[model samples]
Target: MPFIKLEGGKIDKEKKERLISEFTRIASETLGIPEEAFVVLIKENEMDNWGTGGKVLSKILAERGNK
Candidate 1:
């Protein structure tokens, strides 16, 4: 089985579905593997749990006036 893992901030269910479908479709075509043989896992983390440039992602978004 081909494993696909994605880790990031929260997203709506629809986006997750689309991501899984699209990822599997693309991978299947590129690798010549069946979609059913792929396993896709999406991990959603709180923005505060993510960090970049020595700053929490949540704080960075807040500073930029973003949600």
Candidate 2:
């Protein structure tokens, strides 16, 4: 089985479903693997727990006036 792992900030259930379906569809077409043979894993983290450029994600988003 093929595994797809996505790590990012939290998202709504609808978005997660979309991500899984889209990923499965595209990967299945490209790799010639059945969608049922693939696994999609979404790992969500709190904004304060992840960071870039040494700054917490929550702070970065705050700076950008996004949440």
Q: Which is the leading candidate under lDDT?
A: 1
Q: Where does the lowest 10-residue lDDT sum fall in candidate 2?
A: 43-52
| TM-score on alpha carbons, each prediction | 0.96, 0.92
Q: lDDT, candidate 2, residue 48?
A: 92
Runs off by more than 4 Å, candidate 2: none
What are the per-residue Cα lDDT tens digits for candidate 1 across 6-54? Answer: 9998999999999999999999999999999999999999999989999
- Quantify how close model 2 is to the true structure by its C-alpha RMSD in Å: 0.9
Residue 57, model 1, lDDT: 97
RMSD after CA superposition, every candidate: 0.6, 0.9
lDDT of 1: 0.98
| TM-score, prediction 2 | 0.92
Which runs in model 1 stand beyond 4 Å of their true positions?
Answer: none
Best by TM-score: 1
Q: Which tens-of-lDDT digit does each residue in 12-35 have in candidate 2?
A: 999999999999999999999999
